[model samples]
Target: MKRLMKTTIAFILMLMLTVLPACTMSDSAKDLNSSAKNEVGKSGESITLRLTLWGAPNEISVYKKVIANFEAKNPNVKVELQSIPTDYDTKLTTMVAGNDEPDVAMMESGSIALPLAEEGKFLNLQTFLEKDPDLSLDSLVPNITYSSEVGNIIGIAPGPESYALFYNEDAFKDAGLTAPPSKVSEAWTWEEFVEVAKQLTLDNKGRNAADPEFDPKNIKQYGVNIGTFWGAYSNFIYSNGGDFISADGKTFALNQPEAVEALQKLADLVNVHHVAPSPVQAKNIPATNVALQTRKVAMVVDGQWNSSSLADTNTNFNVGVLPVMKEPVSTVVCGMFSIFKSTEHPEESWELVKALIDPEGSIDMLTYGTWMPSLKTWYTEDELVSKWTDNLKSRPSGYKDAVIDVMLNNSHQTPTGYVKNFNKIMDVVTPALDKVWLGQQTAQEAMDAIADKAQAQVKGRRDLE
Candidate 1:
C-alpha cells in the first residue's frame, strides 16, 4: 500500500524509499558530463534564469523571499520564478514535451528526476559539481544526491531525511517504562519494541493488549499507528532485512521470507495482537499531531516532515530512533533541485540550486522541523547543526539522535522500482495487501500468490539489468 496511487496523503512525494532510473556514471568520468559547459567563476553579465517549482501559495511565498535573497546576493543575475499550484507532474511533463522547460527545476525526487534524466532531458551535473569548493556533493545524502543519474550526476537535494518513532513521553511515564531509544546503539529489537507498544495500548475498560481479557473491538487508545497512508509500514520490510527490489534492480523481494515475515508482524499489530489500529480504522484517527497530542495513540512511526505539524501540540512528545529487526535502518525520502537540459544558463542555475539546498537558503524551514539539511556540515559541524536543530520555536526533544543520526548512518533510499515501474508492480501487489490487511489471507499466503506476477513485472522491466 506504499504509494500505490498518484494522490499523496501526507507529504506528496513520500511514497518511495529509493529510485534508480538514470544510468550510472562511468569511472573515467570524461563523457559522463553533457557537452553543456560554462566557466567556473561567478557570472558578471546581467541575466535572468527561469526557475520552476511546485508548492502551496504560502510555501511559494516563502520561496519568493528565498529567491529575493538569492537575487540580492547575485545582483547581476535575476530570476523569473514560476509556481505550479497543482498537478505538478502533469504540468512539468507538458512543459518538457513542449520543449519549454525551466532552466532550474525543483523536481520531486523519485517521480520526476529519474525518468527525466533517463530521457536525457536534464544536463549531467558531474562536471560542474567537481569545481565546487564551497558545496561538496559528497557531503549530501547519497540517497538524495545519487537519486538522479544517467551516465553522470544530474540531480542534488539539500537535505538528509528519514522516518522515526514519535512517541508521547507522558504516556511512557504513565506506562512506567523508559522512553524508546534515542541513539541507534540502544535501539530495540522487534520483540522488545512490540512488548513496549503492547504496554502503552489501552482499552476503554482499562486493559492493555497484554491482558488475555483485553478487547480488540472496543479499543480506546492504540499503541501505534503504522501510518496507513504515510508509507510507514514499508520500513518493516527493510528492518526485517529484505527489500522491495534487489541490488541488480532486476527482482522483487516481496515474497521473500524476510519480507513476508515482516508484513505478518505489521498485520499482527491489528489482526492478531490488537495493539495498533486497523488500516481501515486508522481513518477515524486524527492527523499525526492530533493523534499523539490527544493521547488517542501512544506512538506514530512517520517522516521527519511531520514535526512541523506537531509543533503546536502540547503533547510534550519526543522522538526515538526506529527499532531494529535484524539491523537498525530507515527509509530515506527527499526531493532534489535538478537542471533541465534545455536551460541556457547552466552556470547561473547551478548557483541557485546550491543556494536553495544549502542551510542558509531556507534555514527557518529546517529550524521549524519541516526539513533537515543535506549538507554534511549540518551533522558534522556544531555551528551548522545548531543553525538548524537548535531553536526555541522548533527542535523536538532528542531530534539530534533520532532524525539526524539515523539519516546520516542508518538510512537507505528505497529502490525507485526500475525507472518508475513501481506503480506497475504495486498495481498488481496492492490488491494482495488489501486482502492481507482485511485478514483474507496470511502475509506469506498473499505474497506467495502474487510472487509470479511480481517477479514477472520485475524481470520484465526494460529499465533494470
Candidate 2:
C-alpha cells in the first residue's frame, strides 16, 4: 500500500515539474503575442533584446552608436549588446546548446549560421522579409542570398566586401608605369599583370625582378603581395573558368587544368618570377596600409574594407579591378545577421534585426569604408552612392568604376554561401594548397593528392536542399 502511494506521488511530482513550466511558458508567449499585436513599443511596456556580435573594440563602438540610434527611435525597446571578440562560434554554439541564445546574433554565414539553420535552430525569415516593405531578397545584390532551403532565408549579410587591387600611387609614378585598370573592361590579363609586377619588384640594389642582376635573396620591395589563400585564389580559379567544385557539386574540380594553372601562376610569382613574397616572407609584412605606406609592397590584392585603414593612415593609394585570367571577377562576401527560433519575443527580436541591417541605421560603416551597401539601389542610384562615397576621406577617385560598378556587374558570391560542408572539404584541401604555396609541391600534384578526400566531404551544394 505504501509503495503504491509513493509511486503515485512520484509520478504526480514529475508531471507537475514538466507541466508547470510549460504552462508558464504558454502564458508568457500569450503576453508576447498580445504585446506584438498591439505594436510592441506602442503599448508603453518596455522590452529588452539581447544581441550578439563578434568584433574588435572599434567595431563595437560603431555598433553601440547604431544601437543608441535605434533606441532613440523606439523608447520602449532596450538592447543588451553582447560582444564576443574571439572564439565566437564556439561560444555561440555553447549558448545555443544551453538554450540561452541571444534574440539576434551576427554570424559568419557559411561557417556557423547556415549550418545551424539547417537544423531548424534559426527562424525562417522568408515571411518577414516578404512582408517588410523596406527589405526584399529581390532588392539585395545577386548571389549574396543565404538560404539552405529554397524560398527560405534564415539570415542575410547587411553589407558585402569585395576584392580589389589597392596600389600605392607614388609607387606607380616612381616605376614609370601607368596605374592598373580601374574599369572592368580594361582589366589586365594574368600575363600583363605579371609583366608589370616584374617591373615593380626591386632588390636592395635597385634592380627589378625582370633584370638579370635582380636578387631574390635580397628583395627590398615586392611588386605585389596577393593573398595565396582560398579567399584570394578562389577568385582567380573562377576567373580561369574553373572552380573548387563541379557545377553539380559532386566532384572536386581544383585538379582541373584551368584551376591548376591559376594556382601554379600564383606559386610561380614567388618561386620562379620572384615578384611576390612567399608565405614565410609575408609573415613579416605589415597590414595593407602600412605595407604600402612604407613601400614594403607596391600593390596589394585585398578586400575593399582596407580603404578605411588606408584613409586613416593617409596612404596615397588607388583602387583597381583584379587582373583576370580569363574573365573579370571579384569575390563578394560578408557575415550574416540572424534571429534564433528559441526566442520568446521573435517579433521584438525582428525589430532589432531590421535596425541592424538597415543602411541608414549603420551609415557609418558604409561611409567609413568598412562595408559596401548590400542593396542594389545603393549602387545604381547616383544620389545614394554619393551619400556613402562623395566627400568621404576613405573613397578615392575611381571608386565608382573600380568598386561600385565591379561589385554590381562582376562579382561572384563566395562558395561558402552554397557549398555544403565547405569548411570540412577545405580542411582536407588547404594543407595540400599550403604545400603548393610553400613550393614543396606543384599545384597539380597537391590538388591531385587531395582530390579523393575533398570529394568525399563535398556532400553537394546547399541549393540541392
Q: What is the C-alpha RMSD of each candidate to the true structure, in Å?
A: 13.0, 7.8
Per-residue lDDT of model 2, residues 165-233, tens digit only: 999999999989999999999999999999999999999999999999899999999999997668888
Task: Tell me which residue pairs clash in candidate 1.
Answer: 17-413, 17-414, 18-414, 18-415, 18-416, 19-416, 23-150, 23-151, 158-374, 159-374
lDDT of 1 by residue, 1-465 (tens): 234322432232232212322423342123222211122224455788998887656557667888999999888789999888888888889888888888988776456766787688777777777788776657676466643433366777655567899988899999899999889999989899889889988988989889988888988889988755325766788888877766566677788888888888888878887888886898899988999999889999988887877886677888998888888888876666788878878878888988888677777678777778777777888988888777644577688888888888887765552334666677778888877877789988998898889877764332332
Compute the lDDT of residue 33 as modeled in candidate 1.
22
Stretches of model 1 off by over 4 angstroms after superposition:
1-43, 147-151, 391-393, 417-420, 459-465
Which is the leading candidate under TM-score?
Answer: 2
lDDT score of residue 15 within candidate 2: 66
What is the C-alpha local distance difference test score of each model?
Answer: 0.76, 0.86
Please provide the root mean square deviation of candidate 1 (C-alpha atoms, Å).
13.0
Best by lDDT: 2
**What's the TM-score of each model vs. the native?**
0.86, 0.90
